[model samples]
Target: MDKRDWLILQMVYAEKNITKAAKRLYISQPTLTYRLQQIEKEFDIKLFYRGRRGVDFTEQGELLVKYAENMLKQQQDMEELLWNTGNEVRGTLRLSVSRTFAFYQLPQVLKAFNKRFPKVEFHVNTGVNIDVIQSIYKQDAHIGIVRGDHSWPSNKKTITEENITILSYNKIDLKDLPSMRRISYKTDPTLEMVIDNWWKENFSSPPISNMNVDNVEIAKRMVLNGLGYCIAPSIVLEKNDQLHKIFLCDTTGSPIVWKTRVLYREELLELAMVREFVHFIQDYH
Candidate 1:
């Protein structure tokens, strides 16, 4: 099968629904179905059957999926070899970055780098720190930019750090926090632990957070609207925002800081494109 055929088989098999696969491949449903029929016709075997829930692969289909996977893997390897053969640093550099970093800083970083090396392309995935780590471990991302400290067995560097702070529309007293409504946003385990530990150490009772949101941006907006106070990394704060900021600190009076770092496997540095991007990140900061 051709590369496109292999891709069609892989996407359809992975998604299990023709509609979803078609959307991912940027093709019409009719086109995807026609391509599948063509494949089955050439192989002279039924590949899959539509089911109530989704498409179910037949025995022959499963075997063909394996062959397609192997062929795609070999194709990827061949491309990597060819990319490194020439002096040009040109290839798709996969990156997994924290959603916060991706939102605030990554766009400018990419724009500047692309201006210099227009040949290189980026495939970026944004999520929490744990997701970024998992992406790197699974070899889905060549490098990861993650927030907070986590155990990674390979190469990493702390790019920046920011204080975790209590933000509010008006001045707030620490003693009065338990009575006031607070906003809590879903965050990585590391930051959660940091905030929880700080609360327990400083106060006897729990925070009365009524609003639980999915992300820091939403929680920050709630605080801005005079809804409630929120504890978050100071990176979310804009210079013009008229919010009161109270920094979290250990009993030792040291500020509790959230760190952002870049993680990578040393072996990936063999690719000149990955290596250049990594260096660009260091110099960019």
Candidate 2:
């Protein structure tokens, strides 16, 4: 099928309604319906079950739509590569980063990159460090910036090291306090171990109960509202205007510092745009 047909299929699967998909694609409802019918007839199978409210993909339709989505993404990437192969760096650079890096690290880098390559557009996804790593491995993102130590398939380089600290709003002494509602960053294994060791060394128990938060922004909010206190990197906690540092925790060793890095698979490392971005980061330090 044509690109339009694939686009239509993708949008239909996403929206699940002929009329809504038409509206989103800027086409008429009849045109969308006719195109869908043509696809079903060509495949000799019904793709969707029409309902009074909207539509739903059948079992076979779901499988086809999944492939259609992947095909569309590859096509977009191909077109972008062809359009941007000249002197100027241009194309959509998909990135996934942790909120910790997004707020504390990426703004300046992004500004400098934009100044250098004005045509390069960024599509960023933010989550915990683990999600960022997975995104890069899956080829859903070209690059990832995240906290803690990570080992990907190939080409992992450290960008920066962040110092972490425990913070609280209350005036209670941190020495051997057992009843504490502690908020935790849902990131890497190393960070979790560091935090666990920090607790074992400082407090009598694991801060009463631990609460895991997906987003660092929300973790800061909970600390501000007195829901719980969290241990975060100074790079992130220093920027929080609402929360105040309760104690400067003493880690036995070099402290639980997060080492932020960029990872790439061998196949993607040789791409022109990828090399430019990687070098931009490497030389920035």
Best by TM-score: 1
lDDT of each: 0.92, 0.78
Clashes of 2: 0
**Residue-level lDDT tens digits of model 1 in 111-173:** 999999999998999998889999999888889999998999999988888999999999989
lDDT tens digits, residue span 63-145, model 2: 88887888888898787678656776777788898877788778888989889888888999998788898898778898888
Task: Report model 1's TM-score to 2 decimal places.
Answer: 0.94
How do all models score by TM-score? 0.94, 0.77
> What lDDT is obtained when candidate 1 is compared to the true structure?
0.92
List where candidate 1 sits over 4 angstroms from the true fold: none
